[model samples]
Target: MRQVLLINKDPDMHSDLNSLFQENNYESVILDEVETGNEALRKVVNDSYDMLILNLDLPNTNMLGLINKLRLLNQDLPILIYSLELEYIFIKRYLTSGVNGYCFFKNGDVGEILDAAVRISTGKWYISQEMVELIVEKALYSKKIDRFDNLDEQEFEILTHLIKGDTVANIAKIMGVHLPTVSVYKTRILDKLRITSLLELKNIIKIPLLSES
Candidate 1:
């Protein structure tokens, strides 16, 4: 039988997953339940588990750090991220961090959740359909931003200041340029970015900075 270490702070989630595993007739047992990342690390180090289902919101340790430590200890263990965070950036980061699968608790159905577990257990990656769509959308949005790469350094600087809620006059003062020069730069940036107004600029610029947070 395959053994799984389920790390989540919510007892109800643990119970639900246990029931789901049993109902699916998976010969897998949740061997341990841990509430925090530190406990998870200690358990995985001392005990044995074929798979790990991890919650991103662990209280006692950073999520990325815990995954890194677990990867160091057992490179072959299948790690599945069970998170409520719907941000594509977070999902992308976890996928890049050696996690074998991802399932959003709120958006994922039971079948997808089970499939994620089964697939990861067999050394395959699994991501929900919604997440795949989100990734694709982000990729397309990134391509749209690439069009503005032709902006000169000063124009790009001005764009950054504009995104940060800087007024045209304020940007001119900061860059030590006349207001008319800044206005011209702003017009050129808007044209290059293919945006018509400041609101559009704000919306377009948000995607590029999503991964930073």
Candidate 2:
């Protein structure tokens, strides 16, 4: 039997995952759940868990710092990032931090998660083929390029528009969408970077260079 500790806030999710794990014939893997980072710390420290599943959205948690601390605590423990964000750059950040594998949150994807956990526990790497290729490709580049890589097409467009001093209403008009849709995209962009305001990005981001006759 393998002990896999999952650190996430939602107990409902834990129940659903456990049920799925059992239904999918992963009975040998025990899914222990904890809510906070500290609780996860204590659980892993005291017990000999085979693997650790960390949620990126754990409330009030500095994820990278926690990963570093956990890595220092046990160099051999196979840690997996459990995240909902589909952004490759966001996943790469955590994967590079200290995690051995990742399980992106998708409805009814418990089998994939279990597979990743099982593989990593046995000292084998687990990730998508695209991610494997991407890792190799990205290794040659400076990490600064990945800062805004999480943005999708629309979000990037909105970001460029904002850089041009375009208001949300103006962007809505330009994009032929509702003001609320543009507003939501703006919020998602900020949330992705964990910034409350776009002003914070000015130092890190180059001014959008555009020239028109």
Name the candidate that leads on lDDT.
1
Q: Candidate 2: lDDT of 197? A: 80
Cα lDDT of model 2 by residue, 109-194, tens digit: 66777778768878887885546666676566434445465676567657656655678888787666899999999999888766
lDDT for 35 in candidate 1 is 82
Per-candidate local distance difference test: 0.73, 0.71
lDDT of 1 at 4: 87
Task: Estimate, for each residue in 1-213, the C-alpha lDDT of model 1 and write its tens digit.
Answer: 278888888767777777888888864565569887777889988999999988765543345657788999999999998766565544666687789998877744555667788887777888877788877887775544344445665776576567667777777766668999999999998887667998987665534333221
| Candidate 2: regions farther than 4 A off | 129-213
Give me candidate 1's TM-score against the actual structure: 0.65
TM-score versus the correct structure, for each prediction: 0.65, 0.63
| lDDT value, candidate 2, whole model | 0.71
Pairs with steric clashes in candidate 2: none
